[model samples]
Target: MAIRTTLDKDLDRLKDLLIEMVNLSKTAVEKSVQSLAHQNIEMAEQNIEEDQKINDIEEKINNLIIQLIAQQQPVASDLRTIIAGLKISNDIERIGDLAVNIAKSVIHIGAGPLIKPIVDIPRMADMALDMLNNVIKAYIEKDIELAITTAKADDEVDALYGKIIKELLELVPSKPDSFNQISQLSFVARNLERIADHTTNMSEHIIFMVKGKNVDLNA
Candidate 1:
C-alpha cells in the first residue's frame, strides 16, 4: 500500500509536468506567430529563448517516467501510461522546435511591411494550438474519443496550409517585388502545418495509451 501510494504521487507529478510542457509549447507557437504578424521583434526573440523551458519540462517528465519504471516495474495500464508520456514529451519538444522555426522565419521577414495582409498563417497557428490543447486535455482526462476527434481535426490546418501556399504561389507572379515576404510567409505557414501534425501525433499516443490500439489519425 505504501509503494502504491508513492507511485501514485509520482504519476500525478508526471501529469502535471505533461500539462506544463504542452502549455509552454503552445505559448512558443502563439508568440511566434503573433510576433510575425505584428512585427514584434522582442516577442520573436522571446519565443526562441523560452523554448529551453519546454525542453527542461520534457526532460523532467522523462526522468520521472524512467524512475517510475525502474522502481515500480509498472505493468499493463501503468506501463502504457509511462510509454505514452515519453512519446508525448518527444512530440511536444518537436513542436517547440517548430515554434523556433517560425520565429526564425519571422526574424527573416525583419519587421518589414508585409507584402500581403497576414491572414492564413495566424489562423493556422491558432488551429494548431487548439489541437495541441485538445490533445493534452484528452490525455489528462483519459478521453479517447476527444483525442481521436482532435487528431482528425488536423485536416482543417492542412487545408489552410495548402490554401496559403497556393495563394503565395499566385502572389509571386502578380507581385514580383514582394517575393521575399511571400517566401517568408510560406515558411511560417509550413511550420504551423508541421505543428498541427505533431499535435495529431500526441492525440494518437493518448488513444493508444488508453485503448492499447495503434491507429494513425494522419492517415
Candidate 2:
C-alpha cells in the first residue's frame, strides 16, 4: 500500500512538471511569433532568453521520469505513461527550440518593416499554436479525438507554409530589391511548419500512451 501511494505521488509530480513544460513551450511559441509579426526586437530578445527556462524544464522532466521508473518499477500501463511522457516532453522541448529559431529570424531581419504586409505566416503560427494547446488538453484528459484533431490541424499549417513559400519564390523574381526580407520570411515559414510537425508528434505520443499502440500522425 505504501508503495502504491508513493508511486501515485511521484506520478502526480510528473504530471505537474509536464504541465509546466507545456505552458512554457506554448507561451514561447506564441510570444516568438508575435515578436516576428510586430517587429518587436526587444520581445524577440526576451523570447530567446526565455527558451533557456523551457530547456531547464525539459531536463527536470527527463530526470523525474528516470526517477519514477527506477523507484516505482511501474508495470505495463504505468510504464507506458512514464515512457510516453518522456517522448512528449522531448517534443515540447523541440517546439521551444523552434520558437527560439523564429526569434532568431526576427533578429536577422532587423528593425526594418516587413517586406510585405504579414498574412499567411501569421495564420500558420496561429494554427500551430492551436495544435500545441489541443494536444496538451488531449494528453491531460486522455481524449483520443482531441489528439487526432491536433494531428489533423497540421495539414492546415502545412498548406499555409506551402502557399507562403510559393508566393515568396515568385515575389523574389519581381521584387528584387525586397528579396532579403522575402527570403527571411521563407525561413520563418519553415520554422512554423517544423513546429507544427513537432506538435503533431506530441499528439501521436499521447495516443500511444492511451492506446498502447504507436500511431503515424505525421502520415
Candidate 3:
C-alpha cells in the first residue's frame, strides 16, 4: 500500500537529512586521519570544530523524529523508519565523536615521529569508511542485500585489526623505548576498529528497517 500521510513525507525528509549527516561525519573522519598522518595540527583542529556540525544535524533529526512520533502517530513501517533514523543518527554521531578522539590523540602525540609508517591503520580506516558509506546507501535504498554485504565486510576489518594488534605487540618487545608512541598508534587502531563496529551496527539497523527481523552481525 502506498503511504498516504504527511508523516511519510516527513520521514523521507528525515532520511535525507540522515544521509547528509553521515556524509559529513565521513568527511570529518577522513580529515581527522589526514591530520594525524601528516602531523597537521591545524587540520586536526579543523576536524574538531567540524564535529559540531554533525552534532547540530543529529539534534535537528532527533527533534523531527520526536515530532513525528507525537504528531503523526505512524504505525508499522513508518514507525520502523523513524526508529531506524533515531538509531542510525546516534551511531553516526558516535562515529563523529570517535573521529574527534583520534584527532585529540594526534594532538597529544604532537609532531613526534611515528614509531612506524601508518599503513595498517590507514587501510583499516579506508575499510571502515567504505562500510559506513555502504550502510548509508543501503538505508537510503532499503536494500537488504546491500545491508547484508556491508555486515559481512566487517569481518575484513576485524581481521585487519587483529593483524595490527599482533604487529604492535611485536614492536612493543623490540622497541621498548618507543612504547609511548606505539601505544598511541595502538589506540588509533582500536578507534578505527570501533568505528567499523559502529558501521556494522548501522547495517544491522538497515536490515531491521527492511526485514523486521533482528539478526546479529557479530554472530
- Best-fitting candidate, measured by lDDT? 1
Q: What's every prediction's RMSD, in angstroms? A: 1.0, 1.1, 1.8
lDDT per model vs. reference = 0.89, 0.87, 0.88
**Candidate 2 per-residue C-alpha lDDT over 1-219 given as tens digits, one digit per residue, 9 for 90 to 100:** 999999888877878888898899889888988888889999999999999888898899888888888888999878888888899888888888888988998888888867678878888888988888888899889899999988998888888899999999998878898887888889889999998898888888888888899989887
Instruction: Write candidate 3's Cα lDDT for 103-146 as tens digits.
Output: 88888778978888878787889999999988888998899899
Q: What C-alpha lDDT, on a 0 to 100 scale, does residue 117 get in candidate 1?
A: 84
Question: What does the lDDT come to for candidate 2?
Answer: 0.87
**Model 1 worst lDDT run, 10 consecutive residues:** 111-120
Relative to the true structure, candidate 2 reaches a TM of: 0.96
Provide the TM-score for each candidate, comma-separated: 0.97, 0.96, 0.95
lDDT of 1: 0.89
